[model samples]
Target chain A: MSKVRVHNLFISLDGFSAGTYVTADEPIGDARALFGRFDGRVINGVHHVAEPITADRIFASAWGQGIGAEIMGRRKFGPQSGPWDDDDWRGWWGDAPPFRTPVVVLTHYERAPLAFDNGTVFHFLDADPATALAFARELADGGDIRLGGGPSTVRQFLAADLVDFLHLVTVPVVLGEGTSIWPGTAGLADGFDIETLTTGSGLTHQFWNRRR
Target chain B: MSKVRVHNLFISLDGFSAGTYVTADEPIGDARALFGRFDGRVINGVHHVAEPITADRIFASAWGQGIGAEIMGRRKFGPQSGPWDDDDWRGWWGDAPPFRTPVVVLTHYERAPLAFDNGTVFHFLDADPATALAFARELADGGDIRLGGGPSTVRQFLAADLVDFLHLVTVPVVLGEGTSIWPGTAGLADGFDIETLTTGSGLTHQFWNRRR
Candidate 1:
């Protein structure tokens, strides 16, 4: 069965998934402390890595396993909120984006799909969480759909009970105020079984798997 | 060389130290999920017990070490707001209270001190965090003062930069709404060094020591 999974979501001790402000200059704003220990290498599988992968890295490396397509919030694509006035703004990534699959960007304003050389395509659509997931599912073929988030986007999917697996890294730092993923998820644990592991570098990795 | 320390302070994944509502019957209210793994045997010490001591137990056992006096908020003593209309209402603890030293309860109304057989005395006083700490220091007699909180009290002491050491247990549960200890505590991690350990039982224990 094709599942919907979220991986490597970093949250502060105060439960802020992202910083309060985000601009073109500061992508994460005041939440830089939360990602101080993030290892981008973990996005890929851990088996091929030769750098003596730690438990934290191994846990985070589950991002791209069998995921065919991704659904991301408009903010994750760029800091621009209103209409996409700048047609030149491809993304934070250069010409070659990381995801080698169809990426659906949720936005109110419509834009033509942009295709990259590495099989990465940006499809803009103004749809709800379920609708976005359905679009991603069709694009993913038989593979699973990855729910990429900037926090609010993930909260929407989580609120709609569409997530199958969630991997959250609980950092020790505390952000006084920011966007939270746990605000409306009061009884979220009742439908999911959680397993936690704390690495030597002071990172707590939590895996929430939806009960069948 | 007395220090102000907070221990066994349980916080949910969303950073709520306690629940939203508190009454005479439900002292913790909706925050019961945060205390599901709390083992009260560790408050005194980890030694001399027949049960196997885990890292979490050793961490929580620091609560009573070198703590001669305690300072707690009024809500922690009872759920009553405004003036204490009920004189007969002592506390949640029966004849024998836990603290074997003087406990300063921060309240607006004036009332005589209540003495327990276990050397626990509840002194009601209307004072700020500093004033309350000073009173507890006098009663402590050079021993450290433990900050007993219902969340708001700890936040006041924390905002005042009076806490020397804080031991927080990050539970896996998520409380959607409640009283948080990190609302106004932005940049709080800059003042202290944090150490985190995840126990085998899936409890993440964090220790914050204020820099000298």
Candidate 2:
């Protein structure tokens, strides 16, 4: 079955998925160090080194495997918010994006779908989590739909109970403030059995699998 | 060498040290389940059963190994707010309080020190973390002073950068709203090297050793 999966999402020790004062200068707020621990491959991302395989690299490399399409928040799509005026701004990743699969970017301001060279397509959708998941599910083509998040997006899909699995990498730093997963996720463990995987890099990968 | 310590402190997957709405009916709010993971002694407490050894039991048993004196937030002392009207209420523990050493309870209202049958003597002080630590260190008699917490209290000590070691047990559960440890703890990880120990019981014990 095509499951909705949130893979390799790194959060602060304080449970903040992001940090404060996010701008082009610090696109992910002050969460640069926190997210830096991932060094994993996102849909549209960097870091494709031939370094010896560590647990981080293994998990980071496995990020794009199996998943077909992706659904992300507008924030994850770009630093721009509200009406997108920057015509040249495609995404954070230059040229070839990481998520080679079709991606549904949840946004209020809709635009025509964008196509990248490496099978990466950015489809902007002005819809809720359920509506967006439906759109992504179809594009997934029987494969799992990866919920690429900036935290709020993950929380939305998780709130709708649409996520089949959520893989969270807990970084040991404290960001203090940012988009958090626990804001509305009370009783999240009720449906999922948690699996803990620790790496030599001090990153604890927690998998929340929806129980049958 | 006597080092300050926080042992067996349980935090939810979402980083909540305690849940909201802490009352007599629910002292830790919805965090009862989260904290229930710790089977440690708390200044003369329960569950002294000699069952087969478990990871939690091991950590709980190690809790009082070298601790001399203890300092805790007013919340951890009791559920009563404002002033202490109940002359009969010693603490949550049934009689022979846990700490065989002097205990300091941080509170706004000062009270005459209450002595227990055991060496556990409760002193109410409206003092800051440094002041309390100094008092605790003296009472510790060159032994380690345990920083007993309810989240916010730990945060206060952590913010002061007085905590030499923090042994946190990561319990895989989410209590959406509660007192958190992230706020005002931005540069905490800079001085500590975190080591994670996962038990068969699904509890991840994180030992943060403060850099010398």
Candidate 3:
């Protein structure tokens, strides 16, 4: 069976997956600083090459591994609300996205697929989590499907029980206000076995795998 | 100066300090099962014996140490709401309470002091956080004051900025509904330096100490 997974998702101490005040300028609250700290440490989130690899490098390097397709909320694709007024706005990742996979962006507006040089193609889909997962699975071709999140998007998939493996990192800083990842996920850890590890960089890594 | 501290405070993965639907039948929101797993591990919470000292034993043993007094919400003292009505009701801990210190119970209804064996004494106070802490500190006799909790009472003291050290444990269970400890505590970790450590018992221990 093709697995659905979430990896390298960072959250604040208050359980906020994305920061609040999510404007076009500050897309993910002010948590951009938190995620941007690992800019040079990881190259396309695959391999790490340094004199001494830090915990961030070890965790961030596994961002994209063995993923065939992705399903993400439209907000994660851009900051604009309503219809796509800004056709020129590609994404935060610029001309080349790191996904390197066919990404399904869940949205109300239907637009032409945007293909990037890095094998990242954003396909807008007006479907619920089950439908999106089914559509994404067809694109995945028996490979795993990644749940690219913007908090609200992740919550939907989690509520739909589409996630098989979850790699969540708890950053110590409190984001004050932001989008929460636990709103609809009440019994999220019910059937999943969890593994926790505290790294030297002061963050807690939690791995949850759903029991078969 | 006498310090104010919180130790061995357990929380669920969803940031709930106490469980939901708390009543006289289930005091800790049916979380007694979560806490009862540590039975017979620690002698008095500060000392450990057994051959292999696991994480649960290590964290459980530190329940009470170097404390002159404690401040807890009335719910922690008893399951009864509103006025006392039941004068014979000592506490959930029975005749010999584990706390061998002066315990201040916050409540709207004022009641006389109920002293227990093993140096435990429950003083019901209808005062606010600042006044209650002042009174508890006086009884502490220059020793540290432990802030015992049911979530709401702890939030009051935390909001008043009276906590100096907090040792919180994150248990990897998803309690579907519970009283949260994160309300109104946006930047609680701002001034405190945090240390995270995962133990073999599948729980993450977080130590937060206020910076001088």
Model 1: colliding residue pairs:
none
lDDT of 2 by residue, A1-212 (tens): 67787777888888888875567666677778786666553333222211232335434544554578999888887888889899788888888887788999999999999899989999999998888888888898877788888788888877888888777889989877777877777988899877666776778877676887
Q: Write the per-residue lDDT of candidate 1 for residues B26-57, one digit (tens) a residue.
A: 98888888878866422333221112323454
lDDT string, candidate 3, A171-196, tens digits: 77776777888988887798787767
All models, DockQ values?
A: 0.03, 0.01, 0.05
Candidates' C-alpha lDDT: 0.79, 0.75, 0.74
- Tens digits of per-residue lDDT for model 3, B135-204: 9999987767888886888888788888887778787787777787778888989988776777667667
Off by over 4 Å in 3: A32-51, B1-212
Question: What lDDT, from 0 to 1, does candidate 3 have?
Answer: 0.74
**True-vs-predicted CA distance for residue A56, candidate 1, Å:** 1.7
Candidates' TM-scores?
Answer: 0.50, 0.49, 0.49
Interface RMSD of 2: 16.3
Model 1 residue A143 CA deviation (Å) reads: 0.9
Q: Candidate 2 lDDT, tens digit per residue, B1-212?
A: 57778877888888887877677776667777785555552332222211232334434544454567999999988898997898777888767777878999999998899898878899999998999998888888877788888788899888888888777888888878788877999988999877666766778877677876
